[model samples]
Target: MFTPVRRRGTEILDDPNADAALSLRSLRDIALANRFFGGKRAVVREVATLLRRHSGGNEPVSLLDIGTGLGDIPAAAARMAGRRGLVMRTIGLERAPMLAAAAATRCTDALAADAMHLPFADRSIDIITISQVLHHFEDAEASQLLQECTRVARMGVVVGDLRRSWLAVAGLWSSSYLLGFHPVSRHDGMLSVLRGYTEPELRSLIERATGCHAGVTHRLGFRITAVWSPRYRRA
Candidate 1:
């Protein structure tokens, strides 16, 4: 049994060429974890907030979900948007082909694309989101990824990820055990928390990398969200 350590490193799920079966199992476990541990709720909240703030709750918006896993978050947000009478056209991007194929089953549009080199025009996307993906990269790579996200997003960018802390480690470990998560899922989940960032750390990196000031929040369930956009409203 592997214990969650404070050491910073990459997880098996971070690899583009990770075993397909294991990756799918790991991704499903992640979706389950997000369902119970505030990952989906956190990103949904930000998406709704941005919609209300920037669109006055009625305008149609195009969303690009980066690192989308099974397109869960985008699908959830789309349902929320529909209820609010807002038209949200969503496209999901994944680096792993297997993951992209899985996402296609849930999302109308799913493509395999690298985060650092997005194949989109500047300011072409209305809203961009990257959920639980940043911790896989170093500070420099994370910064570069954010820069690409910011460049393509016209309205704003939302980043929802784990917060590095002992409580987070313990919480995920216990939750995974209780849920009977696969061994690979358990190992990678622990590593994710260990590799996650604090609010200030993410905020500083976003600002330094993109010259865009981001609002970093410590949410419930040991989640950290960093949002930034020229059109965002501060409250």
Candidate 2:
């Protein structure tokens, strides 16, 4: 067992040429973690708020979920929207073809697309979500990614990721074993905690990237979520 330092480090999943089975296994574990913990719940709550605000309309809202590995978050949001009487059309984007294929099973509208270069027009999507994916990028790329997210979203964007803390690392380590996560999952989970950002750090990064006032809130299970609506209208 290797002890991860309290610093950002690349996980094997970051590699484009990694093993497919390992990557899918890790994604499954991640989906389970988000489901049991507050990852999926946090995004669902934010989506619920937006749904309520955009209610009283027959038109279905379009939600584009970026880096939707197993499509758990968007799938959950779509299901929740149905229960709340809000019509939603959920779409998931995954850069990896295999990931996109797997996500398509969970979300019918999944596509293979890059987060940095979204295919949608400006302000085309009602809502956009990026879950547990930000920590993989450096400062500059993260900022660019946020800008892209802001560009496509007409209403708001939801970002959920791990919060950097020793407690979080230990919790992930213990829970991975308890929950029967894969070996790669365990390693990547711990590394993700180490690579995570604090609330303030995330806020600054998002604000810089999107050029909008955004607040990052720390939630249960050492997760941090930011819900930001662009203040300025798209040109």
Candidate 3:
């Protein structure tokens, strides 16, 4: 329920080593340090439930989790999809080699690749998800990535990310110290808040990029979640 801001071009922030450092930390601390994991779990669960309900029975589902830092959500999706006799074929894509290696240990398949250029063929994936990852891209790249997600996904795309607000900033700052996260985690967490897009802004970008409107909603009070499908497809 956030309004769109005036569109403006911005520089993309690159932190190639950020995910690598996080991977080196204690897994427990990494999970606790990032508040979005819990919210992302809920969102993924809800989406899985919806997909199952819509599919009318359990069927194999392929999921491409872009920017899957630690493969948590993809792993969760695999479990959820498994209940319906659905083979959860998941490919976790990460830019950092260390994170990709860590993710491979967590999930069966992991690939190191750029978000802007996914290795999958068009309409090859059932679902494409980006959790707490899109804000790392600038406006233009974010739009392009959205298009790529749509191109690669046959069913739908789900985005789970923080909603930029002063309250969010304050919460992140307090929790960073409380969780004893690494210095880079705390610093990047705060900066990510500042860089995050409101729900409307995300919707506008999706609409402009895909020439199709998208639905945006807030999740877990402070996270912005969006779901978009191709114009020919319904979600």
TM-score for each model: 0.92, 0.94, 0.84
Question: Which parts of model 1 have CA positions greater than 4 angstroms off?
Answer: 1-6, 56-59, 230-235
C-alpha-based local distance difference test score of model 1 = 0.85
Regarding TM-score, does 1 or 2 come out ahead? 2
Tens digits of per-residue lDDT for model 3 on 158-202?
887777777776887887777787776666666767777777788
- Model 3, residue 147: C-alpha shift (Å): 0.8
Off by over 4 Å in 2: 1-6, 232-235
Residue pairs clashing, model 3: none
Write one digit per residue (lDDT tens) for candidate 2, span 1-235: 4434447678978999999999889888999999898999998888777676684488888899998989999889989988877677889898888889999877759899889999999989999999999999988999889999999898889899988888788888998899999988898888889998787788888887777877678889989998888755324
Q: Candidate 3: where is the Cα deviation over 4 Å?
A: 1-13, 17-19, 26-30, 33-37, 53-59, 231-235
Question: lDDT tens string, model 1, 182-213?
Answer: 98899888888888887778888888888887
The order by descending lDDT is 2, 1, 3
Candidate maximizing lDDT: 2
Weakest 10 consecutive residues of candidate 1 by summed lDDT: 1-10
Write the number of the candidate with greater lDDT, choosing between 1 and 3.
1
lDDT of 3: 0.71
